[model samples]
Target chain A: MTATAFQFDDVTFAYRTQRALEGVSLTIRSGERVALLGANGSGKSTLLRMMDALCFPASGTATAFAAPLTEAAFQDDATNYAFRRRVGLVFQNPDVQLFNPTVSDELAFGPLQLGWEKPKVRDAVDTVSARFGIAHLKDRPPHRLSGGEKKRVALASVLITEPDVLLLDEPTAALDPASRANLVGFLAREPGAGRTVVTATHDLDIVEDIADRAIVLAEGRVVADGPVLAVLHDVDLLRRTHLVFEHRHSHGGPPAGSHGHMHSSRQEG
Target chain B: MADQRYGICGCGRGRRGALDSLVLGLVNAEAYALDAEATATRPGFLQSVDPRIKVLALVALIVATTATRSLVVLAALFVAAVALALISRIGPGRLARQVWVGVLIFSGIIVLPAIFLVPGTPIVHLPVVGWAITLQGLRSAAFVVGRAETAATLALLIVLTTPWPHVLKALASLGVPAAAVAVLGMTYRYVFVLIEAARHMMEARRSRIVAPLDGRERRRMLMTAIGMLLAKTFALGSDVHAAMIARGYRGEVRLLHDFHTRPPDWVFLAIALAVPALILGLQP
Candidate 1:
């Protein structure tokens, strides 16, 4: 195995008296785009949170970047910062991540936190903002933007960090059609050679656009893992869970029509 | 039935805390009262005025009002401020309601009873607490209460008239300091964000459990909201700081490149300064 990006063994977590996660084991490899499917309260976000180190599993060990995140994961600032450098988190609510008055500021947030020099921070902001086609939104306050604009800004903020592992919670929950398409398209835009993406969402339309791998979690435990296309189209598998949309592909070569399906529920750009 | 906080919206009075949260909210988005049936309110002349001039005028007015205590002069000042406030086109009904809720509550806590407790020209004395009444005390209370209301009205009028961003631009030009502006800037940026988070929390809560809560969930929801909001604000603030850094935000705050003072703005500034200077110099 080419060095597992994450290794979790029978992990459990609780918030005071309420248990948020229970015995779960999974290994995520680099260059894998995994879509985590489940309804709200299915502990999908909780598992993702643990992976982001936003929360720690109560029982069992979980490891990322060769460091065990169980007991004393957040001890040193340098280590924690480095861990964050490798892992980036995007929240479901666009407003939560966008705290800057202007678009460019929102984009520069993470890089500045990591203390990138002024020039690098500016470059990152410009590159990400432009990629989202939001260069004109540079000086605008985040409050006044349309929902789609806000989402783009939020994503730009995370992309500026240049993390190896991306953790997203409901990435396209409130975006408009074009915004959603732009977002999915960007997510599909090939990540770096060793980058990994893990997103918690029930929206399957995005699976074809992004996921190369899949992880279906129910009640905080893994149910299945396989290729994105194979795991997503398994009628029996989707029936047991809320994930139902299937991605349909058009054929360009011989025998391609044999696998063509009805439709992909992608929100049109 | 248990009452809920109605968020400064009078209609939601039965829903929640019955307080006038409208002032901080007027230019803010969180408490944005979306009336699909309601028409967008037109900007009054004061609202349409250049933000920079309004800031200077309001600041000058507040300073002058704070520096005076003569009841006759202050009463006249209050009257002038009220007339000017009316010109902003806020309906009489709304203005009256705001004054009663805003100033009365604010003044009562500090100075309302002082008028009777203390004696100034012995205009009036309390039936009870008459022993505390003194001319100087009465005068002092009147000074603060009257001036404060006048100044506050002027301040509120400025905010209600001009949009928040324009005000920030104006303050930046006048050298009001970047640190203070950042506080307002962050609030404008984050209040809606926090509110949005609260809405999601409410939505998530609604989607799951049928009844109110098991107390654990309720507590969790509240804690989660607080934690998430705190995390959100800190994250945003850091991002904003970074955004500034990326855009070459040094310690010193600067005006937006598009913002510039025109000839009329300077003339307006001149008039504002002249009036205040004339009033201050003319006074004893």
Candidate 2:
């Protein structure tokens, strides 16, 4: 069996006064491209953060690469650095990640932090800048980029680190239609061999194209774990989990892909 | 690399001014990052020069110009400054528009009692206040104004030429402590993101303004807006942090080198430094 990439055995968490996660037992294997499907406040993002070792679970076991998830796992700066490089996380909004004056610096930030030499850093910056089609944007201020461009820049920033696993939170939110299509196509086709990618998204259509499998979460526990075509459209289960949207008419068809977005039934269409 | 790339920068003063700004700011060794950029007239110039040299040069010039009370020397330094700015391709008008705060330094000492203090002959009487304008007073005022104008011009020229990165890069190259460069680099990257976030925060609040509030509620409304902005800023900070982590940053900074000093750079440096060094060396 593939070694566990990320696993939590009865993990639980609380945010100040509210309980966020409880008894969430799951094992995600290496190279598993799973889409994290959940309603708002279902502890999806918190779970992704735990995998990256950003926030610790209040109780129970969360492990990555067979190492028990603990403060000691990140006690050494090198360890924390390696952890960050190993599991990258992209936010929904580009405003959170891109803080540089130009595209090159923003892309280079990660590699230099990884302690690569100057020449290597520069090369990496250039490569990723081109990869995201921002090479011309090398000198442009990141904030001025269009919504799609900013998103691409943000992704390039993380990919420069060449992470082993990618955790994306709402990888597409607030993007225009063409850009969204571009992002979908890119994510679906990019290199992820031997690397795990778990994306938390509200747009079920993305889950159809990019992800091979799905993990459904609602109210902090996993409800369904199966292929993307099956779990996403399970309307009765989603409604039971409080995740069925007012727009979803039925499930069980060509998946909840973009074409079926507010229309409800994909079978009818 | 592209010649026409800077046209879209929107500084509106043509390319020469922009390039001068990119270069001079580096010479003056201005503090960098978005904060400096926000208050700064130009940052791209300073980004190319070695930070330590720029810092030292700025400090040295400021001292040489400000230490004395001689109109003739002050006038010479001011002329030299304008000449440098012109050579750098920064417009005189751009310099004028750039340094409003700098003029206040001369104004602060405008009413000084140099005439009363100096053991020299009085020159002319004032028309309005009937105050005696002594030779010493005129000399001192000229010195102060000239000194400030020269100093301001030099600094402003530096700012116009340098970008924030080059200043920091120069600092790091010049043996600024590692932690300092690391912090500065990180913050500079974040500032652009923060500004973008700020725009969103403001818009989010603005969207809720279906109807305008009365005069008395304006303060409270602004306070709420500020509070919301701060809260969103923090949230964005965390999200950005996560995004950076995803990008695979490990807290290292490596600045790209835009210049390897040509013989011309040395000649320029020699001329630039020689004038000030000679002034200080051959002081009366």
Best by TM-score: 2
Residue-wise C-alpha lDDT for candidate 1, range B23-101, written one tens digit per residue: 1333234443332101112445555456777788777777767765457767866776677666666655655565536
Candidate 1's docking class is: incorrect
Model 2 misplaced regions, further than 4 Å: A240-269, B1-60, B67-69, B100-120, B126-130, B178-215, B241-258
lDDT of 2 by residue, A114-202 (tens): 77787888888878877888899887667558999998988888888788888888887788879988988988888468888889875
Which consecutive 10 residues in model 2 chain B have the weakest lDDT in total? B1-10
Evaluated at residue A245, the lDDT of candidate 2 is 40
**Tens-digit per-residue lDDT, A1-269, candidate 1:** 67777898999887688776778888998767888887667788888778877668788999997788853756666666677778877777666666556776567656656667767777777788777788998867777788888877776677677788888888888777788887788788845567889888878878778888888777767888888889877877775765554455546756656463333233322
User: TM-score for each prediction?
Assistant: 0.62, 0.80
Distance from true location, Cα of B206 in model 1, Å: 15
